[model samples]
Target: MHDQARHGGAYIRIHVTKQGFDPLTQRLRWSDLEQVLDTGPFPDEGPTTDDPILDGVSYSFQVTAPGRTGRHIVYAVWRAGHADQNYYMCSDVRFPGGAPDPTTPPPSPPAPNDGCTAAYTPPGQWTGVSRAR
Candidate 1:
């Protein structure tokens, strides 16, 4: 999905299962990055809809799913900057290679972010939006 730079908002596109879809061997797993664009600070789900901002920086998304015969297939992508990593399922990952520059400054503080949320398990921590995905 493309953000298209409308209202400085991000876009997300998920692919549903189609015919001929088959399960792999190993269990599938993925890491949802809260930050994608190199810019800092993330916006909330519901914003004022004014003075919207969109940075090009992005984060990495790693997916490992079962392959045929219980094997495992790993997929990773450094894309989806405009997509804001707004995903809820594991799928194939396509990318060039390697992460972009690591020195890019983070986006500004999130003006608002109602579009994202997460739970903190033991040993992990949960916080408010502070970066972009």
Candidate 2:
């Protein structure tokens, strides 16, 4: 998993493979992403194939919290085209006051949560739609 930050907030841009880069930090940033989701518990459950997904396309993702009262969570599952570079790793994501307990997820999305800054999900079960950059 990879990460990127913006708007004075911290978020993770998980990539199935290292593709993009952040010019400043000089790190492999996320890019060409297609879909993203919050997988934690109940409101933020996880590892379910039922989770919505984009097709075999190169996708980019990131997690961010713009203010102090913000909580954080793990933004997982990244797809990088049809190439299978499945390496496993994790991010040391932190939030407002202090880093949240790793055992628990920050919170569910739409709760002041920043959704995918990219992608276009059209009406009626958005299955095979491509978002413009």
Candidate 3:
């Protein structure tokens, strides 16, 4: 997630549910929501102040899925410390249980100097997404 305006610290709340999100209504079926998977406050990597003109930050989390699972949706809400607004994102994930398959290898690490900047100007866009460089 990209904080374009360099807003101060923020809190991230993640909830997992079997409920699927509706694109037409822009809502999620909360009936299957049992509990929140994880929550964390951000700007943990550094301090935030109004001094700098631009402050961009990113955060990531590793959450454990339920043992018995088929398909699930993870919702993340980002609430800025100084703002009353909240941003939302939903991700669909699946867990197929059985023996682990060796054919599908683990995810590889991000390449060095991939153009992800922590502060200041926006980092370069994802490679090969656009025609213009």
- Write down the lDDT of every candidate, Cα atoms only: 0.32, 0.33, 0.59
In candidate 1, which residue ranges exceed 4 Å CA deviation?
1-9, 25-43, 47-133
Question: Which residue segments of model 2 deviate by more than 4 Å?
Answer: 1-62, 65-76, 99-133
Q: Write the per-residue lDDT of candidate 1 for residues 3-120, one digit (tens) a residue.
A: 3332232333223222222222122323322222232332322322333375323333232222222212222222333454433334444233323434765554546767898865
TM-scores for every candidate against the unseen true structure: 0.18, 0.21, 0.49
> Best candidate, lDDT-wise?
3
lDDT tens digits, residue span 10-100, model 2: 2223323222222223333445222234322111112233323521222233544344222323235432222432233444333446433
**Positional deviation of 131 in candidate 2, in angstroms?**
78
Q: Put down candidate 3 lDDT per residue, 56-92, tens digits, no spaces.
A: 5555567664653455677777787677878888886
Clashing pairs in 3: none
Model 3 lDDT on a 0 to 1 scale: 0.59
Candidate 3 off by > 4 Å: 8-10, 18-27, 38-40, 44-55, 98-133
Against the true structure, candidate 2 reaches a TM-score of: 0.21
